[model samples]
Target: MKGGPVLILGATSGMAREIARSFAACGHPIQLAARNVARLEDDRADLETRHGVAVTLHEFDALDLASHKGFVEGLPALPDIAVCAVGAMGTQEENAANPEKGAMVMRANFEGPASILGHLANAMEARGSGTLVGISSVAGDRGRASNYVYGSAKAGFTAFLSGLRNRLAKTGVHVLTVKPGFVATAMTEGMDLPEKLTADPKEVGHAIRIAVQSQKNVIYIRPVWRLIMAIIKAIPEPIFKKTEI
Candidate 1:
């Protein structure tokens, strides 16, 4: 393998799975992590056979913050690059009816990703080299009632990655904040997202891999999102709040 061991959180999901495949194609060992380890057997086998690289599966649950420390320590080898693809987009209406759903959305999207990446930050800092990739969302550019639960969590995650990158800049470690506006994945299956602004999971994989290799601080999966979010963020709150997404 060329690249060092690369750990991918939420590996069984849409974007994360594609990312694992992309790195594996480049002869990088894959450490696929998610809640249902058994479901990843197919992906693991495919990566191993197709790319002729090692594929290791680790059971990971983003909600279980207590296990994050042990999870890193237990890795067979320290990862040279880590990607946090863990996120959940819950229904705002259902979330309003069930506040716990909002809490889960926050924890799954931000708290857990931050917890694991925080641990990696400390380790990578001590080691003095590593790439941290956090997949945030464009929804975070501003809170829209349409998806504020998801947006707010992504906002926190984006801020966290920014701080981590700043702190680790002096060191060899690089942290990247990835804000993907809209993507066609299981998470967004029900939502009718616009075509131009939305990207595919494979596209997300490409952006993340490139960002990690180049050590960019921030990236929009599709360049169009930069312009879209720029306009969204530029709008006045009073006017924005009245306009629906």
Candidate 2:
């Protein structure tokens, strides 16, 4: 699982791109997959030239379930590791006002990512090797009214990853769940996130690389999030519902 190519789904994402760079720096062949072929190619060239490792690009659309199987089948070889960073966090107000928007958020964060991982998990289990890493969120631990639409989707995704990990435990394939709090990236570019709590994409990238190498099952990128979420989760529902997060 360590030597083969690492396939990064949603490769063009700020976080995923950083993770790809980290792995590429470690001499792992990179298979960059995302909806933007142009961006993937750009990244391919950069990683190859910078890290001196083989980098391949693949066109991937997370919501396209029908295409997922064919996408994996088309890889040059089965990847030793797969990182899923596919997610969409629409505005809470927008998602609350529009059912379609909420549905899209749910699909992007849960259904679509889960569908692709299901395929990858089966393939890896059959081979009795490989690793699956999922980028979830701390919001999933407790659904706040501010972003329930996004949080609920991540909650489902977290549960899915946990179940997948349990099923694959005896199979040799490792599954790692990464829950990051506020990350400084395009996804939260305009928000005034706290400097102490917000993590840089490269910091997240380095953490994920270490977690995978160490075969960790679950990790919170910022350890403070574990304590914060625990307090929120411990609140009584009646009182918690009355307070804003």
Candidate 3:
């Protein structure tokens, strides 16, 4: 049987597009929301043509906190599955050097995503059914010097998802937290990521689909990340702070 409508926020990103494709392929109608709706025309057309599923686009800006409630209210209908693939990985050096830049990254990765999901969570709780997926990062498991700013933001988001999950446990609303360690996408084009540690957008996308279907509370896209983060977290802070990862 076909699933209910799926909504993907930040639909312009490579990961988000692939997630949309995954759901579309499964006969789920898609609603893509991003800052630039016009740019999503090609994606909308491609999904409809390839999957023979309905695709709709809406303009959404994550940083626009005030618009979040209105955005949810405006949806044609509450999605059975809503995924927040909204995040930006600003360079560590840049973020550290510019407070403005660091704040932007913070707001982008945490505040914006959490706000939107909060609104969606309320709606889903009222309806007593729906899946909320937040794409967080493994960096949040423990903060490192390499990208502490981004890591901290994701940490907050991870915590938010956890609390949301706890609060909605008996409400029939499910929340999922996805930690995609190292995804190879345009955002990380120039970074030197270990081949084995990095996953393609398609892999992450498919993993998320399966996780949602299985009603998993949290998942590390690559099982190894769970181990890696555990090791990192287990290290004593005094010694860990001195070493450069």
- Alpha-carbon TM-score of each model against the true structure: 0.97, 0.98, 0.99
lDDT by residue for model 1 (29-128), tens: 9999999899999999989888999989999988998999999999988899999999888788987789899999999999999999999999999999
Which rank order by lDDT, best down to worst? Answer: 3, 2, 1
Compare candidates 1 and 3 on lDDT and give the better one.
3
In candidate 1, which residue pairs get closer than 3 Å at backbone N, Cα or C atoms, i.e. clash? Answer: none
For candidate 1, what is the total of clashing residue pairs?
A: 0
The lDDT per prediction is 0.90, 0.92, 0.95
Clashing pairs in 2: none
Model 2, range 134-227, lDDT digits (tens) per residue? 9999989989989999999999999999999999999999999999899999999799999989999999999999999999999999999889
Residue 63's lDDT in candidate 3: 99
In TM-score terms, candidate 3 sits at 0.99
| Top candidate when judged by TM-score against the true structure | 3
Q: TM-score of the candidate numbered 2?
A: 0.98
- Minimal lDDT window, size 10, model 2: 1-10
